[model samples]
Target: NYCTPYLGYPYYSSHDEMIHNLYHNDDCMPMRGFYRWHIQDPICFDEDLKVTIQQIGVGYRGLFERQDDVASVAYWYQAEPHNRFPKLPDKEERWPR
Candidate 1:
C-alpha cells in the first residue's frame, strides 16, 4: 500500500503533502498504521478457504530520485513451506503516485 499510503478518502490528500507521514528523527521509524476488525474468528483472505494465513509488507512513496529508507516486520504463525519471493520491480515502476 505504500504506493497509496493513505488509508481512506479524507486522508488521501494528506499523504502527498507529507501532512501525516513525516519523520521526526533520522534514526527512528514510524509505526505502520493498521485497521482492526472485530469478528468471531481470525481474518481470511478467501471465502472458500477460511484461514489466517496472509502476506503483508510495507513501503515508502516518493519521487523517482528520492530514495528513502524503509523498515518492516514479518511474522509467521503457520508451518507451511514457502516459495521464493518475486524479484522487486525496477526503480521506475516503483515510483509512488
Candidate 2:
C-alpha cells in the first residue's frame, strides 16, 4: 500500500542515480527502469474493520538511458484538473474479468 503524509502529498526520490551506479558496476550494459504510482483509499467494514484499497495506474520513470547514449528520459504522474478521478465509460465498464 502507498502512504501519503498527514497534511500533504508524498514525494519520491528519483532512482536515476541508483540505476546509473548499477550500470557502471556491470560493464555499462543498457538497462530499463520503471516505477508505478498507486492511489490508496481506506475501506471501512462495520465499526472496527478497515482495509486499504489500492488503484494502480501506468508505470512512470524519473530516468531512462541507453547506457552508451548520452540523452536522458524522465516521466511522472499528473492528475487531470477537471476530473480528479476519471469515470470509466459505460461501455468499457466491467464487473470482473
Candidate 3:
C-alpha cells in the first residue's frame, strides 16, 4: 500500500486516491506525475519548516524499511525582502542519473 500519510492530513491516503479526488478521473497517468496539496486545504508555516519522506512495507516477517528512489519539487510564497538565493549546480550536475 503506497500511502502518503503526512502532517495532519489523513485524507491524503494514497497517491491514486488523492489524484482521483483532486483532478478529473481521466487526468491521472501511471508512473511519472506530481501532486499539489494547496488545492483542497492550505497550510501556513510562519517559522522554519522541514520535510521528510519514508518508505515502509509489510511482509511475512512483519513491517520493515524499504529502499526507493524519490524526487520532489516544492513551491512556496514568501514575504517581500527575501534573502539572496543560493547558487545552483551546473546543468550537467543537476541532471538526473
Off by over 4 Å in 2: 1-6, 16-21, 24-47, 58-97
Which whole-number lDDT from 0 to 100 does residue 8 have in model 1? 25
Which regions of candidate 1 are displaced past 4 Å? 1-41, 46-79
* Model 3, TM vs. native: 0.45
lDDT against the true structure, each candidate: 0.41, 0.41, 0.62
Q: What is the full ranking by lDDT, best candidate first? A: 3, 1, 2
Per-residue C-alpha lDDT of model 3 across residues 1-97, encoded as one tens digit per residue = 2335333322322245455465664454333433455645766687666778887979899999977556777667878998898899999998866
Better of 2 and 3 by TM-score: 3
Judge candidate 1 against the unseen true structure and give its global Cα lDDT, from 0 to 1.
0.41
Looking at model 3, report the run of 10 residues with the lowest lDDT sum. 5-14
Q: Scored by Cα lDDT, where does model 3 land? A: 0.62
lDDT of 1 by residue, 2-96 (tens): 32332322222212333443563333434344433324454444224423333444437533342334333333345458667689999999885
Q: Which portions of model 3 show Cα errors greater than 4 Å?
A: 1-36, 80-97
Backbone atom clashes (below 3 Å) for every candidate = 0, 0, 0
Residue 16 shift from truth in candidate 1, angstroms: 15
Candidates ranked by TM-score, best first? 3, 1, 2
Best by TM-score: 3
- Of the two candidates 1 and 2, the one with more favorable TM-score, higher being better, is 1
